[model samples]
Target: MKIKGLSTIRQKLMVFVVLLCGVLLGLVWLLNVWLLESFYTHKVHTDLQRTADAFSLLIQKYETLEDPSQPNGISPDFYSAVQQPEYTTMLLGKCIEIADANYNCLLGNHALSSGQCLLHPARTTLFGDTGLPSWNNKNVLAYRAQTLADGDMYFTLNGQNGMRQMVVCKNVADRYTVIVSTDLERIGQAGEVIGQQVPLIAAVLLAVSILGAYLFSKWFTKPITELSHAAREVAKGNYQVRVREPENADELGQLARDFNTMAAEVGRTSELQRDLIANVSHDLRTPLTLIKGYAETVRDLTGDDKQKRTDQLDVIVDETDRLSGLVNSVMELSKYSSGTMKMEPVRFDLAQLCDEVADRYRNVCEQNGYHLDVQTDQVCMVKADPDSMSRAIHNLLSNAIHHIGEDGYVALHVKPQADGSTRVEIIDHGAGISKEDLPYIFDKYYRSRADAGKVGTGLGLSITKAILISHGYAFGVDSELGKGSTFWFVAAAAEPEKSAEA
Candidate 1:
């Protein structure tokens, strides 16, 4: 069964704390009511027993200093020792007596006037009867004395001066009997005081507990509450909302960090989605308009003129091919992103591959008054998917041609390293990429400012990055403003096949 008003963590935490404090307060009250008095009585008994034991040891040590004039049956030195602060404190609020085997009052006869002594009856009516059976009773004394003589300690409870008292007796030096008495009335008094103050203590504790619980719950749940608000905002398409991260390295802090990262990604994806729509619309509308315009020209104007009709039809075919290329780029990127495009790796001369890709761009560059230089005469063997490698090289070449510098030059270099690896580079003497754009230049939808209105899709470099990454080849770019850029990758070389010279 669910209770009301506990839907949030704060409410649940407060309730848990309240229940905890209640259980603790109940335990304190129960201990005070049920076990406190007995515990105090037992403590008093233990204290009296320790006093008796201390007196026995002291008496044994001074048994040789007998003095008939001293009521304690010890000399002045023994009496001075007993007068020290420690011994005096131990003897406070307690009556002690010592006796020989003949039942003589060797010590504590002064207690008779105060009526706290069990061995002697009260001499005055001021303190009334002790109501103790062992009070000046010979039979009880004989039995207790005999038990002490047998090397065992003895203790009993009895009424003294209208209050209960605990008595501990022990044999000292096998010659003297030591008896220590302390009243148990203080135990009763303490229990009564605690019982009276219990309600007040419980009230203060409950108030403090509730306040602390509230503050703690608020502090602990603040981040979570903010995160909830941020999440709701994100659901409503407000991806810019972010929550403050906590200082701790705990799960809450990690969740906050992850949430912020996810929010940033979502925001980026949303921006990319918008960019994709705009770019695709612009790209498709031009070619589609061209195809429609040229088709109408062929239908209406170039009817009987075969030469003009074929030319117009050829324009339509080129525009259609451009549209088809855009579609193919999108589909290929999707395949690469989804990990569904399988690679067929083989050993081949990397330098030869570079030359072949450069050859395809040769006439285009020459026709556009741009130079295509292929500096790959070395035979560097490498193992990789040749088709993907060719695509990567072609994309780089195309990107360079589009951004070809005023000098109208682009170069491809394939250099063999001493480690038997091949380093391939595509250099364009065009306006270079900015450092700010370098880190994300290869992202799926990212394009540098320099390539803002370029003719190609932005997915070229991203597809190249995916291809190289899948092959586990190391690739990077170096560029400076107005100095052009160099894009490169290193491919591990495969062993060369045996020559026919042997």
Candidate 2:
């Protein structure tokens, strides 16, 4: 299913980022809710166990100094050490109850006056016992008391009044059993306070994350947005619009650069289309006007005169042939450019082909007082479609003929390169193409101002370009404004045995 409003990349990115943030925040909340109280409970039990262990060690030490004369089976110095500031600090949030095997209280520290300690219960006197059970649940107390009695050195218990207590029942030197108890309600209260603030903190963090997500999405999708806008402008026939190319060597930057190139090519093509219309209209109208005017002359003025009528009729035929040639060139160019013109490549001597084509053009060049020179010192053989290649050669020869120098000199050469390729060149000495016009010389319908009034359609070079490109041959032209131009194409050399077999 397609979702609305998130059709663009920016919206989808924002939603994805927000969802990621929410998932992380949810995990943090879950850990706090499920594990925070347990963590606090574990810490309370650890402290109580350490206090009980410390008191047990002290009782063992007092055994060495036990004089039957000392009261409570402990020396005065041992009692003072038990009440030291550091030792008392360990019992800040806790109560310590030391008792004999008969369960008579021997020492009580930090006990509440309201009978809070499970073992001591009251502090009125050394023998104080309220006769009230310290545990609200007798079943719980009985189970824990049995566990301690079953040879367990120490045991911890939790009472219903939010208290946790640790009991070390080892009679050290047969003197004292120590009980250490701490209230766990403070840990519970701290957890509750943190729980209350979670929602507010989460809300603030979520808001910040959402805003950051929006900003990040906007930054990331800026290029795509510009490209889309440029595309729309192009669709509306504004080919000049372009997007800013980014400097980073990423896919998005490559896309922007390619888009700019495409826009430039499209703009050039659009301009060429306009040129095609103008050039075709001009070329077609000249011959058509001649044909119509001469046909009228034959019908109205030269009908009764044999010589004049024959001449007029011949002119009409020539003009009609020119029209046919123009139409044929246009159709052939379309075929070559569209890649519908198939090639039947076979190995042939390029030098021999150049000689044959130059020979064909010799009569036309002589009649026009132009010199056609052909120099082929070596037999350069290549594989290509013969008919298409012949047509390309004819076009280049015609182009050179029209643009030859005042001395009427044009040369065609066939040379074998050091690499396994053959280069064919047609050179003309007429007013050569400028550097500016050389780049567009092979573009269809592109005619430099120098050759604007030349005799043929401007598609000859373009047709040659398409033909060479189809054969995978490289072709180029080198020219200076006053030094004339050399149009050439290079084709890979083919083996004679392969040609003979083919």
- Who wins the lDDT comparison? 1
lDDT of 1 by residue, 1-502 (tens): 4769689889999999989999998898778876888787778888878877887788877775458786544687876776677776777677766666755444452232235655444332221232333344684467446755576555655654456656677876667777767655656567778888989998999999999999999998988998999999999999999988888899999999999999999998887788778778888999999999988887888878999988888888998999999999998988777778999989999999999989998889879888888899889999899999999999988888877899998999999999999999999999999998887778776777777776766889889998988888899999999989999999987867678996
Off by over 4 Å in 2: 27-198, 495-502
Locate the minimum summed-lDDT window of 10 residues in model 1.
Answer: 122-131
TM-score of each: 0.66, 0.67
Clashes of each: 0, 0
lDDT of 2 by residue, 14-45 (tens): 88888898898888777676677787667767
In model 2, what is the error at residue 119, expressed in angstroms?
A: 20
Against the true structure, whose TM-score is highest? 2
